[model samples]
Target: MWRQSHKPTKLFHRAQRCRPRALALLALFLVASTLLLCGIKGKPSSQYDPPKLKRSRTRTSTQFRPTVEYTNGTDLIWQIPESPKAVLFIAHGCNGRAANFWDRSPGCPYCVGFPEERLIVLHALDRRFAVLSISSSRKCWSLGKEKHVVKWITTWWIERNKLEKLPIMALGASSGGYFVSALAAEMRYKSIVLMIAEGVFDTMGIPEGYPPTLFVHMPKDQRRMRLIERNMEALRRKGVRVKEVRCLEFPLSPNFLSDRILGLNQTMAVKLIRMFSEKGFLDENGYMRKDGRATRWKQALRERGFPLEKYELLNHIQEELNLAYGYHEMTSLQTDDIFDWFESYMN
Candidate 1:
């Protein structure tokens, strides 16, 4: 029979058809994915899924920063906060250490507390459970080598561990002003607050359009206080945040102004800090009621022993405001609100 060679059987025809390659490939992929999941089950959470980073609660917010590292072998009087996130690196004035910046001391009139590290922490609590302490550097500044150190500390810390990338704020009163200014000028810091501080910057030559800075120099007494006003205005024009607090006691108060040459105790320092930093702590007219009686700020200074007449904080309210990590008898630093402003400032 001319049946062209026997027709192939149905089974033979089906065998010649293409294999289920698509289905087999899909099955292989599914198996591989399952293996990956099973393998990851033995790994740490961080390996399988990264840890969530802590971001600023607000465009401005505060939180504790743990796991910090100090670079340049610099010795800091570091104090972890009761709560944390905000850090204050205080540069001491001439003949000063971080300890000398308190307000009240005995035998000295107008003093309420001995400069203590704890009070700084206390002041920062209102802003957030923050930490305020100084690092011991010898008249160092951000103008030159000091600037390198500032960058090193920040970079070193970031590379060293996993802490929220909260930037540090620089502050200094009197002699410590130089460091603060240099830092503001050189480093990529969050911001800076200069209290009764400013002078010829020994090392800073930063051009315009640098980090946002705040200069709060003595309005009445610091030498060059009035002169720097023009520069301060210029900085504001450059978009730098600046506020010159006119000490009601200044000019009226002596130049070496000691609102509190030294401190009385932490208790008293706490009270004055509240009075000065908090808005409502002082009346709308800038007077705080005493026992429901009206009291002038200078008079109150006298009552508290911060006699505006003889307390000398700076020779040229301007020169001593430098912050070159020098020694300090004490610091008249603004309270935690300085940090609160930082939140809004950075945001």
Candidate 2:
């Protein structure tokens, strides 16, 4: 009867409070133990790890495939190798496309049977270079406009390939050489290889702090060589480094008939005939008669703002003939030498 109306004892109240506190402590202990077990299970094993690195194989050959990009109406053909050490910008001659310079194709009407272009590309790929061939939009290069286009293309290429710190080189033949010369004066190119660059030095003045230049020419390419030498002298005067390599020497053989009747080397003969025909020195049938009055080359030089004496003019004409005839042959023969020279500066 007394228990029915009883108030809770102090001991019972204390026991009830301790029961809630104990339950809370037990829940906290369970949570801590669960977290400790999860941490131990989640620890990484020594055998497996994240953030893996990838290895890429070195590409040895371009074969026939190249990535083509069209920017600013110019075709930029790229033959890029893995881990490129340097960059080579190639500008083809007048009426020449990027394909003709990267590969020895039959489309180039002026030259035949020269695999130097193909070989150069292959060698560059082997050397781990990102080679670029820039095609002119028109029949010939417009230096003023093409210069900016080339710069833009190259800058884009280097950025895309992550080659911002690599050394840059330029190679050009004939008119392409002229373009490269102008570009080199404007930009900071490591070096330039010019093959049969006619009147480039006269057209583009040697800039202060110009890059080291390698002029490749035939020993008989007197006119262009004279111009190159004059430019080299000017560069020297301005304290710029330069080198010239006279390739494909064609010395007259002891055989009198071969030397005289053959009319210079075969390359020279073809070039001379073509030059004479172009300058109106030959008949309509492409015949050069001995009695034809020589064009006043010195007067023409003066008219073009190149002031040279009569004797110098005659020598210049002869040199021009030599260059016109022998350029293709000389370029073909000296392709390896060009690569070697370029290699020296790449380091």
Candidate 3:
């Protein structure tokens, strides 16, 4: 009977050892199953594919598929069609966003119409060029602050889109023009287009080994145009290929009359007259009568020795009061021509 009891005790000890091992094995199995399930669930669906290269149907009607991304606290909106041959980077002017380039809402400050945007973007895509529009971090571009960041983002984008071997061109307007000009000094670009660029380049000095550049401006903006021409001349002197296109003609809208005159309240009008008189564009008598006629202003500009023949004078009085109005008018008229010029160098 004692031997029998010993046998039962031995069996009990063996069972105890096996039970712990069994529990451990069961726990491990459960963990493995859980991990396997997670792997299956987390896998990306085959139906959801990544962006693919698409062939453009026609130059005039190529469709653009735009995507927006945020990198290093900057907004980069880009359109990459299939197998792009090159890339174009566009910098927006002061208080402008990437969306402003494509957005055509009435509220958009510098809205280019949808038809125009389509024509430009699609034409680029058809020619196998990816387009990127970058917005500034602040109200205006700060090249010192944003240049490195922009460079990194642009490089990353080129790699991500498999456009490693492609050439890059830049286009900018106003403050954006200033940004690109500064950037060109640091980075290599195939070409650059500047529209109504600021006079910042004079202070900075034109950098050596800069790329070919095209400057587009309104003739009536004598101060800014003179600055651009001066820079262009300097670039030419350096043996850099540079060209300037003066948008001498513009069509004015009927509502432009209201925008020039009635848009300003009596208080604003009085202030404008005072400013104009101080600029010597109006005599004290003309200022007193609030004479905003083109004829009178032309006489003032002529007396100042401004080359009137170089400018296409619209039949309106308000052109003398606002330089921006004149600039915008030219932009509308010359959008297609600008694109054509850009295309000319793409080859």
Candidate order (lDDT) = 3, 2, 1
Runs in model 2 lying further than 4 Å from the true structure: 1-64, 103-114, 249-325, 328-330
Residue range 1-347, candidate 2, lDDT tens digits: 00111565554455456656534543443333222211101234332222211111112245545766678887777777888888999887776777654432333332211234555566677777789887898988877887898898889888998888888888887888888888988767887888777436566677677877777765444677678778777777888767765543221111211122212332323333334555565445322332222445334435544334422124323432332234333133344456666777875
Summarize candidate 1's per-residue lDDT along 32-139 as a digit string, tens digits: 322221111125433442111111111123222322223475533333444446555666655454443323223223322232222343455445433333444665
* lDDT tens readout by residue for model 3, 1-347: 00112244543455455656634543443333222211111134332221211112113455445677778988777788777778988877676678654533333434332322334455666667799887789999997869888888888988998887888888777887888888888776878878778436676777777888888666556888778778878888887787665543212222222233212232323333334455665443332123233326556556655455654222223433332234432132234445555666665
Error of 1 at 69 (Å): 9.9
Compared with the true structure, the alpha-carbon lDDT of candidate 3 equals 0.56
Q: Per model, state how many residue pairs clash.
A: 51, 1, 2
Model 3 bad stretches (over 4 Å): 1-60, 103-119, 252-325, 328-337
TM-score of predicted structure 2: 0.57
Of 1 and 3, which scores higher on lDDT? 3
Clashing pairs in 3: 53-82, 54-82
Q: What does each candidate score in C-alpha RMSD?
A: 30.0, 36.3, 30.8
